[model samples]
Target: MKRLRLPIPFSIKTNMILAFLGVSLISILILNLFTIHYFSEAVKKDFFTISGEAQSRLNYHLDDYFKQIASSTSTLLKSDLNQSWLSGKRVHTSDDIDNIQMELKRYVAFNFPEIIGMFLVNREQRIISMTGNINTDSLSYRNEPWYDLPPNDSLVILPTHRTAYPYPQQNGTPVLSLLIPIYSTDDLNVTGKLVIDITFSKIHDILGKSALGKTGFFFILADDRIVYHPNQDWLGMGVGRTDLASLSFDREEQSSIQYWNGDKMLVSVKRSTITDWNIVSIVPFDEMSSGLKAARGSTFFAFMIVSVAIIAVVPLVSNIFVKPIIRLKQVMQSVARGDFSVRAVDDAGQMEFQQLGHSFNRMVEQINELLETVYELRIQEMHVRLRQKEALIQALQNQINPHLLYNSLDIIKSIAYLENVPRVEKMAKNLADVYRYTAKYAESEVTIGDELTHLSKYLEIIRVRFPHYFESHIYVNEKFHDCLIEKLTLQPLVENAVKYGIEPKGGHGAIMVSAFQDDAVLVIEIADNGPGISEERMRELNERLAFITNHVKDKQLPQESLGIASVQARLVLKYGEDYGVALHSFPGRGTVVSIRIPYRSPKIG
Candidate 1:
């Protein structure tokens, strides 16, 4: 598979924005993670501390309730009914003892509302005194575990069991018993055992009051057995079957997290000082960490909002930072294209960018000033070169004048001696006319008619010198006779054809000078049927001409093509780059030199 790429090049602004957002998002995520972790730990710590405190308070209340039961037992032992039974002095008959026991039961019932029933059993007398309704079948005093204990004053707390004679208000509920053995004062012998039954409902009331957080509750355990629980089904079950069964009850109070009912929970255990039972408070982990979870959610939401804000804000900030640079780049591009007038604006938002813009503007201004100076220098150099070329042309023309005058005088003298007076006169007159025209050089531009008239006279002299050696033709329209052109423009081209083309080709060639109007420009072409320029030489000459026109100051005129280069330079000086000379040549055929000039009528003096 081909990898996809962006169509447009990445810009600095986009890159900066992406980089900033990437860093910001990562920071936000990290901060949010840490915040959530810290928040969760803090909430868990607070929750456990609160639950442990609640369990401790409940244990204290339950311990106080058990102490009240022990105190009630002590009070009963000090009662006259308990003393008389132990001493064997209060009653002699069964009728009298039963009446006294009935009165004692009423007194105990009126004093302790939590008690379900009370019983007094004597092994020596083979009798039992009981309070409330009794079931003889369930009340086996002789085989009871507490009855077998060694005689003692201290009370014994028994495990919870169903009461044999449950109070009507107790509704057949289970009860926790406290047994106090009665002993004789003289012999310190075991006389009787007083049993006080406390209903499970009272313990339930205490456990229920110790409420934890949501979904938290308390249970009472006696020696690792659940004695009282809110759920009746858990009551009487071994503590090992429950969630908190693994808890070590070595300490007076402890708290920890454990899996309860297949769910993690925060469990706290507080031991009761009275019964050595544990008050276990359980709060499911989910419930205890609810506040932490909410805090995490809130932190995540805030992070998302901040991340989005960073994403949106980064681009705008990058743009604010990059806008001026973009403008500066555009201005620099313009300057590279030779538009030195352009400059960067100094209105960037940042101080550094503003300074950069100011520097760019200063650089452009300096470049523009240097370019203006260079342009003026180039114009001055062109003027100086043109003056030098004109001077050289004048000197060449002066050298031609004396040579032609001498040859013309020799031809006239010879013709005169040969009795060819008319021809001699014609030749001499043309020679005088050529000399006169060459001598007059005041005007820089002339009409085509005047230039052509001078050219015809010079050609007539040339014909006189070498009759039938070369032929010349002019095919200029009369309408162009008044058209303005550079002076001596056509003369040098004709001279070149006669000397280089016609003379080199056995002095027998045809030279044609033609003029025509092409659009707004006039074209003067000089064609010669002589030994033509070779393809290589023509290309070299054309390249030289182009170089001269393109780099006017750097290129020097070729020595062999001085006349042609001079004409081309003058024409460019007058008409600019668009109007110049062109050469067309073919080997062993002919050469055509065409001069292109903008057509304009001769200016009046």
Candidate 2:
């Protein structure tokens, strides 16, 4: 008998179905993983967004509360009409307190149902209620825990035993009490306590109603101690009992949202800016992220099912087709390990392998081009920074020595005083005016009139000091007085002209300072008829501008160089570089330093 043969069934259609099922399973598994992450992020984002909105609403409530109080107090304070009605009344009649209570109750019913009651206690600690039923005078409420405890310590919102009424089933309700001290109108002396009783149930209703997905618990806390909770029994319970000490909201940082405890529950709490009462909202980990947790679990189950199906079907298919995939995974791992040179090698001579190889080469080329461009930009950025540093240093070194110049003038006054001369006193007065102007408006860009006044003082001081070094004349067009110029700028230029031009050329030499506005530019020209600069020296000066420019470019310099550099720098920094110092000179004639600045007027709001 011949051996029985086992037939192998192979078809293109059968293979295609196996491949399609395999790819679909893996795709679903990967997509499920991504979905888990996406849902988690979306949940956290929504939670934070809602928390912020809740915080805003809480602030609005407090702001409205304060505004109503302030408006009432201001009305009482300003009312001359109500003086006789409010003065020394026994068993109070104005109904101002009653009206205030009614308004407060209305506020609670409409805007802030969170508030329990607001009441005022006078200097005698008399009790008054808006409900109009509970007679606190016979109840001896002033001496009770509610009134006495608050007046003694105004800073703390003291938690006390809940008060019960006379009737049956009128069990004590949990209430948080705050005391705000008010003073006499004139003396600022504390005369009463603004007693506020906040019901825990009301707060719970407001916070709990808005809590949609999660089981949210909120409570009023005084410092680290819990004053009240939604559950009436938990009222006056210490926070340590609830393991709140381990929470991220410690004694401090009660103002913002925080995540606390082992479960990663998000907590948001805020302290009242006026009363220091803490408002806290707690969400448990399970309740807060129930949706996301469900999503993750569902995804995990789907991934496992798909993975198992893929594992079973893959082996029965072609080992040759799967072998390239295994090689591709190894290449990916190598690349992850920083081996960019790693490439997939195809042994089966498949078209897919050829396509992958081409794709890898193209990616490498793009990466290289990107790296080269980044490197070039980095170098160019470094060059620009170097230039900036050089410019900054040059500016710092050329700062004006204003103090030294002032000291020299002061010395001249001292010398003339020792000589017992009256002219010295007159000169000193003029010098004082100049110094005052400089010191007073150091940062201000002054008007032409102010600058001219400051210059006249300087010229008077120089005349007293040198007697007759040069004749000074200033010609400011009346129309240009409205034009603005940098304060004390003209003084420095005039000083330079006198020292370099007039004094060097000897006595009887003249100096001219003129100001005029032309074509939207304020021009001030200082010309001296003296032996001016030589052409060779002018060329030398222009060439040496590079050195000056480089020095100005260098950012590091001593504080003394700060003024000239500062003045030049500020002119450029404020009005742009083109609107500053220009020089023109010729041998045996005169030198002119022209300053052009943008015209601007002071604007009133």
Candidate 3:
């Protein structure tokens, strides 16, 4: 059977089209990134400002509500204490209070549609009369929270509670009970508490009708306890009794201007001018920033349209700009792969492309003059890149040793878990942090603050691992606390000091690690009291220093020795000759490894 081979076609137009598309896509991506970043930041700032403004306006509205209540209550007090009313008090009938209740009811219904119900509880301890469908027979003056309030110098609005008022619908509807003590004319003795029932429906009627958008609730609270909530069952309750408080009122929410509860929610509360009463309003977070949301949506859509337009136009623009260049690249590639037989076609009559056509013709004439030298140089460059790639791989391996150390810490945590120890969680958390820092080598540089955080985690894990064999001490200078170092640099050095320098000592050992900045450089030393290095081995390492630029290229030592060399090599490669490994050891006393590098500030950019 004969095998048929398909034709391998090459086209200059196709290559040019593809390159133009790629460049256009990359340009669009970069523009979108920058535009989207600025757009999102602007949206967030506007949202925050709008939320703050809405909350302030809400607080002002609440103040206005309470002020109206105070004025209306004061009117009732002035009228009820009239000399004619006192003289006619001998009648002492509900009719006498009824006259007062009727007039006040007219004032409230006309001015405050939100006023749910109104009443006058006379000095006789009987509810004199009420307006808006009052069931006087069912009302309990003695047991009600409103009736019990002391007739003090100022009026008070009680927290929310279920009230039986306003006739046929007098079920467990929420209401705020406003109480003002009625006093006699001649003698300024304490009189009966004149109570007014301002229903939740009234608040709903006023705020709900006028609210431009968003669902909101206006209620009162007595400290942490609910006075009157729209959710009637949750009213007159304390914090732990309801899920609303748990979800909505965490420690952080107390101080935050705008808070997130699944969605944004803005809150504002004000203390009443007349009493200890507080009026609070809650509005949907989005409603507070609806204007900003509209702006953001418009901006986002505009950006998207612009992005699509840019994406669509760029390739067309680039095709026009780089048509000649694309043809040049195609001819060059063909020549690069030993297709010297291929030649440019000067089909375009345009002057620039014609010039390019002549240049291509000249290139074909002198191929033999430069081909061999170019090939040799290319091969040499490839060899150098291969060596560099190998070195990079080695460095990566050495840098990742802390990953194994993290696994060991995890094992220790599992043991702690099995033993039902409370400290296990703490140990596990620290172990996780250590691995987090070690794994974040992609960032390459981390702060002294972060290094200390990682070291603290490592030591915590080590403590859990050994339990009895080792105790560690960390000392950091105040001035160098914010310096930056190569990520994961400290953990390996400390690990080596513990494993090699301390463990070999027959009994218990101490590992002391200190970090300080001096002479514009960071000096970190990990010293331990255990088996110190021999003079001969130290001299041998000192001799090989110049040759060993990284931990991976060095000859294999024991696990502990490898950790120290790995840390030193990374420091040198990253920070240059000024930064590297130093060893101090006295045979019986112990060993110490010190690392020095110029103190770079913590990365903020």
Ranking by lDDT: 1, 3, 2
In angstroms, give how far residue 602 of model 3 lies from its true place: 74
- Model 3 worst lDDT window (10 residues): 248-257
- Which portions of model 2 show Cα errors greater than 4 Å? 1-42, 66-161, 164-171, 185-188, 194-205, 242-248, 251-265, 284-311, 317-605
State each model's CA lDDT, in order.
0.72, 0.61, 0.64
| Predicted model with the maximum lDDT | 1
Q: Which residues of candidate 3, in runs, are more than 4 Å off?
A: 1-143, 146-150, 163-173, 182-192, 201-204, 214-605
RMSD of 2: 33.6
For model 3, the local distance difference test gives: 0.64
- Per-residue CA lDDT of model 1 for 1-605, tens digit only, reads 99998675679877776666677678867877787667656755776678677877877876677777666555556666556765667555556557556755765667667775666656553445454222243344434445455545666787665543323444445667777677665577777777677766777787777677666887777886777888776665676787556665554455566665588776667776667777777777777677667766876687678668867887877887788788889989999998987878877565998999988898888888888999999999999988876675454344434434645666675677578687777777776677667557666678899889999987887777678676889999999999988777788788888887888867688889999989999999999987789878888879877876775444444454337876776677667789889999866888899999889895632
**Candidate numbers, best TM-score first, in rank order:** 1, 3, 2
Q: Judged by lDDT against the true structure, how good is candidate 1?
A: 0.72
TM-scores for the candidates: 0.43, 0.34, 0.36
Q: For candidate 3, lDDT tens digit of each residue in 1-605?
A: 99999764745445555556566666656766666556545544554444435444544565577667767665556664333353345544556556666777776767766666666554544455445323245244445666655566566667777665434566566677777666655576555556676666645444444342457665656777776566767776785677555334332212223454576555545544444545555666565455556665665676567667656766676677567777777888988887877777676576777777777877886775578779898999899766774565455545464454666667777888888876876777686666656666666677777888778878877777778777888888766666777767787778777777766664378888887667877788888898788999889767655445544333442333346555655666667766777888888788888889887775532
lDDT of 3 at 99: 69
